[model samples]
Target: MPAVTADTLTLPRIAPPAPAAQQRPVRSVTTAPSGYEGEGFPVRRAFAGVSTADLDPFIHMDQMGEVEYAPGEPKGTPWHPHRGFETVTYIIDGIFEHQDSHGGGGEITDGDTQWMTAGSGILHIEKPPEHLVVSGGLFHGIQLWVNLPSANKFNPPRYQDIRGRQASLLSSDDGGALLRVIAGEVGEHKGPGSTFTPITLVHATISPGAQLRVPWRPDFNALAYVLAGNATVGTEARPVRKGQLALFGPGDALTLAAGTSQPAAEPNLEVLLLGGRPIREPVVQYGPFVMNTREEIMQALKDFQSGSFGVIPGERIPHT
Candidate 1:
């Protein structure tokens, strides 16, 4: 993947649109994240194991932190290899620095996002910046694994670093909601990250009693993950709170209304809305490799062991 320089980082601007009429009722299938520890940080795995089959195209989602780390206590994932898919990391707070075999890396701070396509293969490391690790502070973020279609599983690796200010912002006509487009189009706004499959990913915050109706492709499967506060979703008006993932039924649009009461955490309701066209391909995954067949996964392992996964500058470790 080529490094993103100032000349190439362009931000998209779209005029905000009037709120759409409630055309379809939104329904929600609620699920909770299972607790687990990754590397050295604790995480809440929202999509894994049993939920993997239902969230096609999206194999995993991890809610990292919201926990404070004492000085010298912070930790992160070490050198690792990934293939056959892309990883999207959105930083809500603190700072994370990443370095990969392709020599692609940068720091993603509050509200920033990083999208890494591990097409053929790549080894990488992500952790708090050295300064942050020494100073200690709050760290919070979400990481999602998006599965690639079979045809593009072995394509060249790439990366996109999207700064918080570069993301397209859309406001509700009534001034009750704000949305940041990370990928795909939402109303008139478009995100900065390019995706292999047709998908929409947005972070939204709705004010109390405010209603948001966002248009979406009817063919895509849509779902919302609440990051903080409470909100009623879909036409069914099912209530959901933090740490819950809500899968919406078929609909041309998504309807969300924030509760009047103050949320336990933040002042406004925050949720991550994600949708993608189903690939409908058989999924075979092992560790960080996601492919369509077991043989393909085996090939990825062999490539990594043979040091064919590309080289990371200054990396001295070799596969056993």
Candidate 2:
């Protein structure tokens, strides 16, 4: 395996959003809608395994609609193939074992991270460990789809495993906010994710009455998904609460300040900031399938039907 270069990636300097780019970099704001709505936990499914919805350049985001596996249930997705883009799976309160045809496999638990670049083509499958699920508790997480630039649409696949403890934390010294860099840098702390796409993913935690500033990428689209408490984004000072998606228009920076702070005198406020240059490609998808042109979609269908996409991730293991 090639030596892992600087696994931590920092954001580029935020240039002023041009007059044309002065608009919110975000192209759209969308809710997950829903998921498979399975039982309490313990489940197995493909990318379609969860209730997935797309927000423009971001092809799909199965946030809470994502299901989990109870201790010792059938909780692993079979084999699947992805072309033309990348898949980033984040775990907020669970554990996962990801294995792909590119000869990459690892575990991501709690604050840890895993990013898979499914360039050109590759068969991949991810799931919680049998022991962890059987004797383990519930499995919960969020998966995001990022469209690859046209130039890298067919590059060989790659993967990165970032441990939660290893990630750099950028928090204000004066009880303001904590920016957990998962994919890119916020302020100064760089995250432990490596990718070719122009993107930033942060797990931001804001305190009561605390306002933090994050340089905004003028060219890249951006939005914040409130996971915990309430905060505001951009100059309009729009409020963003848990389960709500805050889409940003042209803005040079993002301002997040706390509200009532809720109970305990300091309610936890969290949000995921994600956005990139829009792919603007024609998307056609059907259960574990995402393709650009309709014709390409048809070809993908044919490949899967004929098993031309290659074998399952661990199918070569030949179990006794």
Candidate 3:
């Protein structure tokens, strides 16, 4: 849970919502089901039951392990291909290495973010460092897939390595919570990562019994996913807990409050607040490819099989 930490008293405070601002109401709250990803690493399918319409501009999300891995137990993804979307991987507690066929590679740890746009197409791999694999430790993070609109689906591939300290840090009005804006705008502050679609991604840690109310774009759809502990969402105070996601309805602002008590191991309420301007286009996905039509998906598969993505670097070890 130590993705990034700052003293709330020293951070810029998010202004309270105006009296007339409408607080977004909770439309639904669903629990994420546990699953495995990549080399059998644990994950929570964050958008499992949510409709694509409600998650427009965002295709998929996996809350990767909050698990403490024993020595020689850490694992990672094999070489894979992706197209028509951006993959945002935020490392919260451990080190993770990423390498793509286009010469973009790096090791990120503790709050760092790896933003990879698999526009057109690209081959990539994500794994633990050799040392981490030999001496395993805690690993926790989020992987979010943001869909590109039809027009920009074939743009050149790009990568952004956003350091944890580069995030825009802010505090709740009462200084009871810390907000790390990793992408998009939060009030007058902006984060480091850039995206093809307009979206706001914030990781907030709320002290027990604290409440957070912040302004949101009326045109964007809002969602809150709990990473740790219990919390209540919306003005109506609907209860939500770890692994649960709350979908919000249209409004000018959003509200969330931390419960007074939490699990001993998780003393605070950790939540990811994300919203994006809807793309509202037909989405057809097949395996690693996300496209606007079945024909486009077929073409993507053909392109990948034909070695159009790019060649793997000779120096790196290819994972199976």
**CA lDDT, every model vs. true structure:** 0.79, 0.62, 0.94
Model 1 misplacement above 4 A: 1-28, 48-53, 315-320
* TM-score of candidate 1 versus the correct structure, residues matched by position: 0.89
Query: lDDT tens string, model 3, 1-320?
Result: 87589999999999988999999999999999999999999999999999999999899999999999999999999999999999999999888999999988889999999999999999999999999999999999999999999999999999898999999999999999999999998778898889999999999999999999999999999999999999999999999999999999999899999999989999999999999999999999997899999999999999999999998887864332
The TM-score that candidate 3 achieves is 0.98
The lDDT ranking, best first, is 3, 1, 2
Candidate 2 weakest lDDT stretch, 10 residues: 1-10
Q: What is the C-alpha RMSD of each candidate to the true structure, in Å?
A: 5.7, 6.7, 2.0
Q: Candidate 1's residue-wise lDDT over 1-320, tens digit each?
A: 00111221133322333355334555445566557555769787775433555688788899888789999978889789999999999989778888899867888888888899999999888888777889999988899999999999888999898888877777765667777888998866788889998888988877888887778777788888888888888767888888877776665777788889855567778888999988889999899999998999889899999999987779432211
**Candidate 3 lDDT score at position 161:** 88
Instruction: Compare the candidates by TM-score and give the number of the best one.
Output: 3
lDDT of 2 by residue, 102-180 (tens): 7766777666667888776778877666667667564556677777766776678888877776666665445466666
What is candidate 2's CA lDDT for residue 51? 23
Model 2, residue 194: distance off in Å is 2.2
How does candidate 2 score on lDDT?
0.62
Comparison by lDDT, 1 against 2, better one: 1
Indicate the TM-score of model 2. Answer: 0.77
Better of 1 and 3 by lDDT: 3
